[model samples]
Target chain A: MSALVTGATGFLGRRLVRLLREDGLQVTCLVRPSSDIEPLRQAVGDALWSGVDVRTVELMDENGCREALLGCSVVYHLAAGLSGSTSTLFLNSVIPTRRLMAASVSAGVQRFVLVSSLGVYGTQTLPPGTVLDERSPVDPHPHLRDPYTFSKVVQERVAWDAYKASGLPLVVVRPGVIIGPGRGVLSSRVGLRLGPLMVRMGGGQQLPYTYVDNCAAAVRQAGLAERAEGQVFNVVDDDLPTAKELLRLCRKAGAGVKSAWVPRPLVQPLAGAYEWYHHWSRGQLPGVITRYRTAAMWKPLQYVNDKAKAGLPWRPEVPFDEAFRRSLTIAPAIG
Target chain B: MTTSPSDMIRVALVGCGQIADAHLQEIRKIPSAETVAVCDVHQDFADQAAARFEVPRAFDDMQRMLSEASPDVVHLTTPAHTHCRLATELLQAGVHVYVEKPFTVDVREAEAVLEAAHAEDRSVCLGHDQLFDPSWVQCRAMVQAGAVGDVTHVESVLGYPFSGQFGRQVATDRNHWVRKLPGGLFQNTISHPLYRITEFLTDDRPALHANWFAGSADVSIPTELVAHFRGEQVTGNLLFSTRIEPQRITRVYGTHGALEVDLDAQLVRRSRQNRLPGAFEKLEMPLRHCREATGNLCRNVWRFLKSDIHYFAGMRCLFEEFYASVRSGSPPPIPYEGMLRVTRLMEAMFEQCREREEAGDTAPRHSQERIKVESDHTIKSDQRSNQRPVTTNRDESRELQEAWS
Candidate 1:
């Protein structure tokens, strides 16, 4: 069997490709024309790399993308623009997807799996103690949203739109905050670094973060399982750790440094000041206070994966504590 | 190495450490520069370097390589402390020299190297190659072209990645060579930004002020520093740290506008004064920055796609310039006076630090005692020599202006 995968250069895409290869499927990776493949080569190992084929196309090139997807059985649409303004987000994420999905359909791909984000729920803050499942209502149009969330929201709608209109077998996998290795598991810069400290906000609010490998596994499951077709899945770890607990675990597993907590009220002000300073000084004080993710930072994110658990033969492989510990160490080589 | 053309420059690299690869890789590009020999104190390192670079000769002994290879120039890639002695030896042997930065261990050693360079009547270039970095070159040109109008103040920062293998080694290993330098790791690494900043200010004896914070108990070194340099015309700030993620940035502020030069991203972001009202600036400034950042992103991505970016590109440019000066009898790429002045500035800063320690100001609080914040004036204020020669080097009438793109 042959599988076509987009975003093969991303965090989850690398692992998903590895998983697909291990399953004895020939993998074709649809990479951006200008994307560096050295990282992909490093991620997928040289010895067993013969089974994988990487094709480069400008995302806007519909025919090129369609040609790359040709003769492949399954398609995994995992590529996303991480951050951008509204127009850029629409241009990079939405338009590319609308194009790629059209190409996937034209190529008669077996299954189209869309890797979306839990942010589509905008469940960043629900009523206190409210749990969210796949069927729960989502904000039709999320407001005051970060470009990432807004883009993911719009991208998911596009995927579902294609599914309803074109009868394309699509599965939407919405993953929570992915905590992975400090280096090389996903994005080169993403991961839990051994910083001198892990500063937590919102006084130990519950956070819906998933271990990266587990999230990758869930995504892989969503792609392969027939029952996952035309359905939505919320992928997260079994237990959502509180911000304080996460920080404590990070300090223990990470640089073994001090842990500090800024109260909920103060976080907003800090973020506001940081925003003003960032604009006024042009990032002279970077990563100091961060963007006004005050709402996301302050509110508790409680995601329920019951639908995914019932539908797919997958469970959270790594628990919260183990995931936290593994994030601090070098990721084990998995075949 | 193959037989060279009459104008071909035969180069031998001494000290086959990590940096030697950069030199070897870059030397392959220049048609006239042929790397004839590789040398290191360790025989295995010499052999490995020679095989790696496909050079004709490898030797554990520098003298043996110099005599046998008879190269036009010897690149001194050894530890900073060893630079003075080795450079002097090569210069005395009537060979042109290029030493990696910290040019030498301290002021005295730099002076000795300077004297040797003059005595041999040979060119000696310090590897402050960021001088030729396209980004910095563009930045300096902008300053000259009044892009940032009358450069009033400049700040340059050097950040080390202490979380990686090399960084972890530097953090844990107290016996590392960097820890043994006069100013410890700062003396070893600060030369990068210090020289970059010195290029603009051109003051021989700039006033120095510095504050440091201990990184951690395990590191056993003060890994964070903020140093200010007040000059004749430009006020400068130097931020040095091993705490932050590895970054090199130089921001120049002027009366009309300001520009931030990012070495990592390889771009310059020029910011003009926002003419909007105070309340509206909150909205407009961010939008303006977004415009500049996005514009730079598109440009840099295009450049990258065109294969315009290369690691050690600055090193390659400097090597070319150094070889050019060697081929011609032009003044050296890095003037001897600027080299010595950088060293003197470093020495002066360390001198004040020592004076503070002797003054019984131990356990200085971060809030209270910013010990070496010198406000009055320069060291050797009245009797400053080496000023004119370096100032002339910084003038617009240099040969380096033409080499820049």
Candidate 2:
């Protein structure tokens, strides 16, 4: 199968493009005009890079997107704006997806795989340990969340709208926070980074993490598998470590991370206090630890990947311990 | 509380959303104004607002509330597009109107609303509240009194935080009313800065040039804007940015000195050439700045003690002025001519930006070229001085490390 991959220069996109090229697919890498492709070329090596058709096209260019999408049966859209103002996020993330979907449908692409985030799910109000599967509803009030999550929610909505409107075969893969080399284990799930101190919210909550390589593998399978069309897959590794255990492992590896742990029971009240102070002080303090954000990020919920295992018929190749070790080896030791 | 029921102005409010809280709270502070009825398309919002503010009645329909409560003045706090239609209707119903700004979508809508107000012989006020802040009042007084002689130039900067309630709502919703505006989110907010310029640059039609850019990867609409206005007498520059730290300030430069009014801090300062000779001038300037800072600090503390240092202090001043004008049969606090002038200038500015965007030239190509020129000059300078090569790579590496962390 031939595939067109956007965000091919990103951390996860590089591995995904490499895996697809190895599988002998004619892959066309769509990149932004201002993107630096040297790192991607180095990651894939000169031999594979030479074979890959690299196209620098703006996602907003409808005609260019259609032309680049031609002859590619499957498209993997992994590009997303991680942080920006609301307008920036929408323009960068959501508008491009809408345009790309239109182009994909016009170019007769068979399946479009959208790489979304697990953060799009509205699990704040759900009881603890609730099995958050593919059937769980997306955030209805995404505007209340961070701009990145809001954009992802809107982008996913646009993709699904395209699927329903144009009959463009679609399979979405919502991966948990992708962690590997170049990215450390410290995530929002663990705590807020208040200057140098990491205010770890709760320790017992399991971190929903997917190794970049494993995520890439599942994404590749999502494009190739016969039963994957019209399905949503949550890509998460089988074994996971709680926030406390991850911190323990990091310290054991001689990464002296600065952290203060808030017990699980005290998380809500502390967040309430922060929120109250944020409002009472007339925004002198940043509204980073609101009850809504705290509930969304630090909630103790069970994430199920049964749909991905059955639908894509894929498994995470790298074990959690092996992935953790690989990631820490390259990451700078926390000061 | 001071005014009797018969003498008080019966005020009704439309659009009981986030900004309505500020309106109601400020109106309550004015004894002459009583919020009689509140209305919203969302019944829950109207009901909640009524309960919170202790308004007499609430209505989902504005027309019903207008007829039953019979308010003397109405605050049209609805969305921008709805302003022209609603304001005209309210005027025809024999009620004065106070519109939350971006008074109407375009110059044509603004003119129509103004005409309707004239025909009905009822006063209309545009919510250019920032100009009424104590700091701005002081700055304007200084300019009029020739502290800053013959206002030659003006600069206004309005920095919006996208994380704020209104910004978040617009940013997250694709079909938001703001996105439908001619200049997108800029249309809704550019007025505040533009109005400040219009106060000095009173030319009905200014030669305008604007450059709009997305600035960041996350927004498609122009979040950063730089516009220039060359009026009949004064030159003006406006910087409306979302990426910067939130601030609202305006600086006016005249022949004698410059005045800067920091709206957020409710502080005003003046800059002029030092009178002291040579080396003593340097010391004198710092001492003067220190004295000015101390004075401003004291003033702010006093205002805070009097419970006047508020996010909506300017709005409170605006409300008091408008209500006083209404009661005394004076022209509206914000003149229709000034409102129309700003709206007209805004139209021209947004049009210039739209034309540029349509030409497919939204990228920061100018900055790129400037960087190239500067780098070439630096390389030549370094060779001439026999110094080590410039350290661009180290800065890039450090930036990358910071981003990674």
Candidate 3:
């Protein structure tokens, strides 16, 4: 069977392409015309490569997207802009997925795998005991204006809508903080050096992380396993380490840096003031406040990957320490 | 070796620079040693230091200081380029030598110093006191004891925001050494921590294979140098830079657990037993259990030394080891061979840079000479000179051969 992969140059997309190739499927990659081809060629051998912009329906209209997806038995939509920004989420996640789903339907693709995020829960101020699962309602706050999260929520909704309308056998995978080797923004930007020690919004007790390899394995499983059709799985690891635990783990994994903790109460106000100052001085809103608020990442985001385990026969082979080590090895090029 | 406090070993302080003060301060704390004389190329620096330290003699020439002062030990604190020749001269004259970090600019020079010491049946100790620091000692002990299990890898990073101290020195003609020095910050500062790490981790020395990249700006100094090394069992990476604003840290990854040291804080973390209120808890904890451990340790060490004599007496203990080894024909604590190995590694890094330049690679961002006065005064001084290369005469060649052999 043939499979078409979008965003094959991206961190997750690259991993999915490798898995699909290993499974001996005739793989086709739909890439932007300007995307770097070296990383794609390295991940998946030179295969059928088509250039088309996911955002422009003109490309879809010209049947370029459809042509790529035509012979593919399954389509994996794993490309999403993950800059941790609101606008990027809308442009990359929401709009692109909508376009890709419509094109997949037009091409009569049998199965579609929609890569979603745990951020869609949008519990910015979740209480301590909240455990987010697939059953959790979409309760995004009015002020919860992260474009990426909004897009993921909307994209997942669109996938469900497509599933309802045409019976397009769709599987949605919601992954937590995906970390692994090769390329990750976390390792490149914040992970390489110690800036300021911080706790999540409430003492850094919240947040769950999934190893990148594990997330990829889950996506691979969702794409191939028959039972995963029309189902959503929260793909994460068993261990639920808090932000402080993550810091300790990084140090253990040879980050070779010490962090000084800033009290949670002090962070919010200080971050607000810095944001205000940056905004007033520059006459433009600075994203620093949002970055800092994300830094205060406390909201216990625990998940059970039991559905993936039971239905897809997938298991996370990488232990936490090894995954953490791989996360540090990629030092992102930071200016 | 059995000498007592009253039978003090006479020592000469060479290269009366900033670090010389620290060495002298440490020496004064040693009751078994006395700084009998101070020597420097600059007469004023030597004279002023001798007067301040209350030493009896001062000399502009090191040869004069060695003969006149008859020092049992010579503390070599000169710049990297001059360390070998000066230390060799002192060793040949029957004086034990303690040279500072990156004992020489090149492996050839280091080997010459070792050969001279071996010919004279004396010992040379490179001044890498970080290995002897109490915090490092404790951390090494824990690793040796298998407290953290078998170490698989180690990452060492030493950095500080460019304070412009060395740059300012280079900018002024005061010390052109910083400008001419190879590998810049890595060779000058990071060598200490890197050497200390190698010493701590290995029973047998490891072979270091390194790839280097210059930071993206020409500030007349290097912003970063990264080296990856491996032993039979362990592989490690050393990142040295002056561009990073954060404090220094070193981490060792092991099978069972891990150990991290915050050099700026002088703090260590390892798994240990902790007594909580209700239950006996086995927990991981940082040393000293306080935030400012490094500052606290420094203050405590000062408080322990009630007077200059007390402090100097303690330093003399370290000095006497070099002195007694020279006198009794024993090996120094930090052997000359180990010093040569580190020097060679440093040379290899420079060779990489030259190779890159010859290949027409983009010039490294930081101008090694920019921060120095000499570089500013003489533009493009590093450009290859077309003047006839000075061919070494047979006599000088023979002298070098004799020194190494």
Candidate 4:
């Protein structure tokens, strides 16, 4: 079998490419013309590097996108513009997906996996004890519609659009914040001198976090699993950690960061003020507090990743604690 | 560490960048001010700055400097992005803060600092140098005095010559903080012009139309922009370009007259209708021009003699005013409300530019209205999805950095 991956230079793309190669399949990497290939090379060391084939395509160029998917039986689209205004998000994400999907369908690709984000749910502020699962509608709050989330929502729509139009056999994997080697939310902020204490917004709700390798494995499985076609899975850790516990673990990971949680009641008003400001600013200025982010961090619930577990062979093989520990051990600040 | 009430206002400088030297140069001249320490992330920069400026202490660590120096004021001359976190931290520590421009990266960050300052009852000064520039001060006074009648429109333009080392750095460095900002080149350089026009406009939600173009087909990064704006009572255009000779010109058009300010030359020219016969009007214009030319020369020479025309002199004046407010318990040198208004305008301009770039033929034209127009959607989804709660941090860890509560 042959596999082609867009966003092959990104965090997950690198791992998935290696996974395919390890499975003894020919893998081709389709990257943007100017993408930094260093991370990809670092992810797959020298031995596997020589056999890898590379192709460059402009996402917006329909012909180029089509040409890039040639000779691949399975196509994985993992690239999306993570930032910019609403229009920028649409251009970078939705438009590219449409072009890529059309191209993949024409090239007779059997499976297409869209590496979507769990953020498509917007800032999910469920009731205190509500657990979210695949049955939970992929709903995003109106007020929480920044370009990043809005783009993801639209990109998923585009993928489904292609699926319905061309029967492209699309599977979407909405991964949580993918904590991986040489990259981490908490630690990359070291340069900002955030100091050694992490504050839990809204006194500790469940954060839907997934380690990078687990997410990659799930994505690889999504492409291979016959049952995953036309399905969406929320890829997250097995033992969902509370915001408070996560920070405590962060401290133990040689980060030397401690934890402080502000009671939910006290933080709610501040988050509301920030939401108002974000709208008034027209999504230009992001506030430290957002009602959406506050709700997510204080929801007092865990995410259920049952769909991916049941339908696909991929499980949370690496526990969050071990994965996190190993990641920090390799690169304390970078990860 | 503590300070006596009778002692000079202890001050420490942070982030020994290009602007830190300006603060150090001016800060030392204040009678009640004492430059107790200087600090930077780089030790050599801190040590060299402290030694060069004859400061008594130097430290690479911020907390240690704050702990050891116990300075009443900390000048934050760091990049725009760092303002929110660092300023909030300083404000919590109960130190007066003087931050360099664009104030904070966005309005919320600006509000964050203000909230912290209000919470701690500390002072925060924005490094809006034009607000204190001698030529700008004179022009502003004239505008207030009706030298330009009822101001209706403004054209604020700045030209940059990308020929210097710093210019080359901005041109080449892909990882530059300016490149990371929303407006890219405009974010780095357009604050002055944005504030110039924003000052003349009201705080009502503005309607903006901005378009940008690069110098050549090979240059993809925008080096030129035209931001047309409509506020409640005024309209303005902010023009910026790197292809032109260096000049800062802010012209105000009014019902009765016009005021043209040359910021680089420290000159202001005013024009009014002669209200005479046609031939007499033609004669009056040149006479007015000649008189204005002589006045400009005189003003320039006088300012040079008095050292008011030197670089960063406005910064010095602004700092002195900030100190006055800190000592007298008065309103901030830059009104918090006005600063917000300026930030709004700046962000609006960036939004317009980005909107034009990404918005193609299909997207609905951005409508201009006041607060909270219900955003209409083009793509339909299940109605249940509308009620879905907000979920963040899907694929992006970079945007998930928590602002310390």
- For candidate 3, lDDT tens digit of each residue in B106-162? 877888888898898777888766665545666789889997788888888877555
Scored by DockQ, the top model is: 2
Between 1 and 3, whose lDDT is larger?
Answer: 1
- Clash number for model 2? 6
lDDT of 2 by residue, A204-258 (tens): 8888999999999999999999967888999999789988898999889888888
DockQ for every model comes to 0.01, 0.03, 0.01, 0.01
TM-scores for all candidates: the values are 0.51, 0.63, 0.44, 0.49
Rank order (by lDDT, best first): 2, 1, 4, 3
> Residue B283, candidate 3: how far off, in angstroms?
10
Candidate 2 lDDT for residue A33: 62
Question: Cα miss at A246, model 3 (Å)?
Answer: 53
Q: What is the lDDT of residue B9 in candidate 4?
A: 78
True contacts kept of each: 0.00, 0.00, 0.00, 0.00
| C-alpha lDDT values of all predictions | 0.75, 0.85, 0.65, 0.74
Residue B314's C-alpha lDDT in candidate 2?
78
Q: CAPRI band of model 1?
A: incorrect
- Per-residue lDDT of A135-165 in model 4, one digit per residue for the tens? 6666544224444666687678778888998
Superior by lDDT: candidate 1 or candidate 2? 2
Alpha-carbon error at A237 in model 4, in Å? 2.1
Worst 10 residues of 3 chain B by lDDT: B306-315
Task: Give the lDDT of residue A136 in candidate 1.
Answer: 66
Q: Give the clash total for candidate 4.
A: 6
lDDT per residue as tens, model 1, B1-405 = 653587889999998766776788778777779999999875545655676468899999999998999999999988888999999999999899999888888888888888888888988999999989889888889889998888889899888867654455456555568778777767878889988888888888888886555666655676776778999999999988776878999999999999899998898988887788979978888998899789888987886656567657798899999998999989888888899888998888766655654664423454212311311122234236423122243333232233221
